[model samples]
Target: MAPQSNKQWTVNGTSGFDALKFNENAPIPKLGDKDVLVRFHGASLNYRDLIIPKGQYPFPQRDGVVPASDGSGTVEEVGGQVTRFKKGDEVVTLFNQGHLGGSLNPTINETGVGGVIDGTLRQYGKFDEQGLVKKPKNLNFLEASTLSCAGLTAWNGLYGLESRALKQGDWVLTQGTGGVSIFALQFAKSAGATVIATTSSAAKAETLKKLGADHVINYKEDTNWGETARKLTPDQLGVHHVLEVGGPTTMAQSLKAIKIDGVISIIGFLGGVKGDQPTFLDCLTNICTVRGVLVGSRLMFEDMNRAVEANNIKPVVDEKVFSLEEVREAYEYMWAQKHFGKLCIRID
Candidate 1:
């Protein structure tokens, strides 16, 4: 018998979480000639998901968009011309479908899932073969799902093409407990680099330490946490890398937090956009390279998977698993910023 309509969650408007809508019988995505279709098993949320719905995303947005970029699933079908994947193969979606390699361009923003294009929050997603990568061998669907955005963004920032890449005993300062920060911490630890993390309270600080942070800074208590982080490094010079997810509001501090020749990977804007900009003299004098990271490429994702499998690294997922029907609740939990790692939604 033909399958009943597929289940999915979608953004119906741009007001807020209230705009997210559920449908019991959304049509299953049809595969294109080079497309691969998958039955989604899990999806993970990033900080971007929280803002994308409010029409405040860094990129353009399309109405009635399916609202997630990170997902893992088994191949349900493949187009006749598809060759890379077969039915039943485990796979994860890429953050930017058109971004197979090289430099990201307008098409990346235009074709991005959950942004200008449809996303993977539904029961099924049809993707170009180039838009998918085999899941990490060591991870389950949920953990592997987190790779597309958070994992790749972290990998992109740390070991990506432009990165000097952390070495053993190098100091890395990750801000907050968001998905990107947590992933960066795990990857840095795996590489034998020292990690200094900043959080709001002692409890979360403990959590960061437990996750292998060498030092923890409570930014709320220490308004000058950046300088403190710099001092914690071996030579008291500054950290080798700063995962600057705080954007303009905290970039001035990130500039203050790096050693000469250090790199600051600008990942997000949790403190809101449009604040004081990083001073040119400070960056130039420090010789700091500031790069904007947007997830990663298919090749980079595949390479990171090799590392994830080799290290047996598992993504730290929030304990509260939201069902497909609880899209709003999951987003609300993320908005509260309490999730330790990634916020995952289970599809049944």
Candidate 2:
């Protein structure tokens, strides 16, 4: 039987992670015709999760709303018209609830889970049937939790543009050891592409190599790591895909590393907003495309899951585990950049 009350963590304000408030008895949402009640087994953190609580996100959030978007759970109950899911089925939340396919629009921009609506941090959540996708069978709940945001973003950056889909024997350049970069490495390798990864730490470079990065460059050691990466390619022609996560600061280097007509998928701005940036003329001279990625759609999530299951791709979660009650600590850990891959919060 479903419980009458839901336990959840609510955003207190812009004060910080410590201001997050835990509630023991929030009302269980009344199911609509197409709604399903999910009992979350696990949840994962993202950069947006850290920034939203601190009022750094650009989107407007509902006051004291439940926080977090990446989650995997079981369907405990379903409404009469809920067709996509049923009791006992395991599912993962979609980061953008309204975007099932095609391109993103203004309306879709307002439909993001964690920032624009009540998200998956609660013990129980009522979601529309279309808002959930079947969890990849090969992954555990914790591993599957990481797929909703970072995994999908990586997949979109690589496969969303059909004309430039990653092909076998292609070259891919990944930046740092963040969740998106790590997933890009794994996906590119699975597709038979050679990957060149950049990291400041030698320890992380070694980890990248183990993850099948064909070559690892220590960015700290080589200030012009992008040129170094380009030189590693055949005849210095450069790479086919560059996962551009380090926004303004790294754009100049990415421009140097990309091959003519190659795709540079801009995913994040971890390199700080005010850094030496590339100009329009630089992009014009590079003869490459700079595409911005905003996570991905529900259809993309489904497609990525199938590929993940077929390839037996397991998401790299951090060795440290946090219970639901330790969500604040999880945020702090992510802020410190101590985790190599995805950080998880196990819902007990």
Instruction: Say which candidate scores most in lDDT.
Output: 2
Over 1-348, each residue of candidate 1 has an lDDT whose tens digit, in order, gives 334578888887778888898898899877788998888999999888888878788687788889999899999888999999998899999988888887888767677878766787888888888899999889999999899999999988888745487788788889999899999999999999999999998989898989999899888999898888888876789988889898888988788889888989989888887867767677787788888888778888888899899999999999989988888899998898767889999986
RMSD score of candidate 1 (Å): 1.4
- The global C-alpha lDDT for each of the candidates, from Candidate 1 onward, is 0.87, 0.91
Candidate 2 lDDT (Cα, whole model)?
Answer: 0.91
Residue 333 shift from truth in candidate 1, angstroms: 1.5
Q: What is the Å distance of residue 147 in model 2 from its true position? A: 0.2
Which portions of model 1 miss their true places by more than 4 Å?
161-163
* Clash number by candidate, in order: 0, 0
Give Cα distance to truth, residue 232, candidate 2, Å.
Answer: 0.3
Q: List model 2 lDDT by residue over 1-348, tens digit each.
A: 568778889887888897688888999988999998999999999998888888888766766878998999999999999888889999999988898999999898888887877888888988889999999999999999999999999999999899998999999999999999999999999999999999999889889898899999998899899999999999999999999999999988898999999999999999779957888888799999889999999999999999999999999999998998888888999899999899999996
TM-score of decoy 1: 0.96
